[model samples]
Target: MKNTLIESFVFLFERELDKLEAEIKQYPDEASVWKLEGDIKNPGGNLCLHLCGNLQQYIGEQLGHSGYQRNRPLEFSARDVSRAQLLNEIQKTKLVVSATLRKLDDESIRQMYPEEVLGYPMTTVFFLTHLLAHLGYHLGQINYHRRLIGR
Candidate 1:
């Protein structure tokens, strides 16, 4: 189960990250990635930041010890970041996630996850599953944002 789980996780994470990069690239221009329109709470650029921050903090730093320090506030508040930079972040995040997951094994994944995300301990696999869902939810948001803002 662990081998299958890890393989599945790596594949899905890569796929979603690829989609994320594509969504960001879909914007007509760099400025368009930061465009906020009616009823839109977060622009595409911020979503990219938030997604990369989440993955790097949880999977890269916590699970994989990548030493990434995430600034949660800046993920949302920073503005006008170039699309090139955002795309680069996505690519880096993909590498981190892939490397981290590849290093895990059945025994390690079965142990309690290092962080108590829900105020109680859960297995590492459970937390990783949750992370995938989180990524998907925001990926959908980025998709809708691009469409809504006519980018």
Candidate 2:
């Protein structure tokens, strides 16, 4: 079960990251990636940065011990990041997430996460599930932002 579960996670992460890359690349222009629509605070570029930082921080640094240092503020504050750079970051994040998850064994997946991310203790698998959901949420937002921007 654990092996299958881990494989599923790896596949999902790879697939979603690919989707994210597509979303950013599909933006009309570099400016469109950072354009803010009415009532919306975060743009597509920042969302991509946030997702990269998030997975790198939690999975890469904490689980995989890749020693990643996250600049949480920069993820949202910085703007106009080139699509090329964003795509590179996305690919890097994909590698980190995939490698980290692949290393997990059955016992490791059920163990408590290295940090109390949600203001409470949770199993590694649960936290990973949450991370996947979070990624999807922002990916959806980016998809919408891409379509709605440049209007």
Best by lDDT: 2
Q: Rate the local accuracy (lDDT) of all candidates.
A: 0.92, 0.93
Q: All candidates' TM-scores?
A: 0.95, 0.96
Judge candidate 2 at residue 94 and give its lDDT: 98
Model 2 regions lying over 4 Å from their true place: 1-3
TM-score, prediction 1? 0.95
Candidate with the greatest TM-score versus the true structure = 2
- Inter-residue clash pairs, candidate 1: none
Collision pairs in model 2: none
Instruction: Give the per-residue lDDT digits (tens) of candidate 1, residues 26-123.
Output: 88778788988888879989999999999999999999999999999999999999888999999999999999999997678889999897789999
Give one digit per residue, the lDDT tens place, for model 2 in 1-151. Answer: 3348889889998999999999999999899999887998999999999999999999999999998999999999999889999999999999999999899876789999989989999999899899999999999999999989955
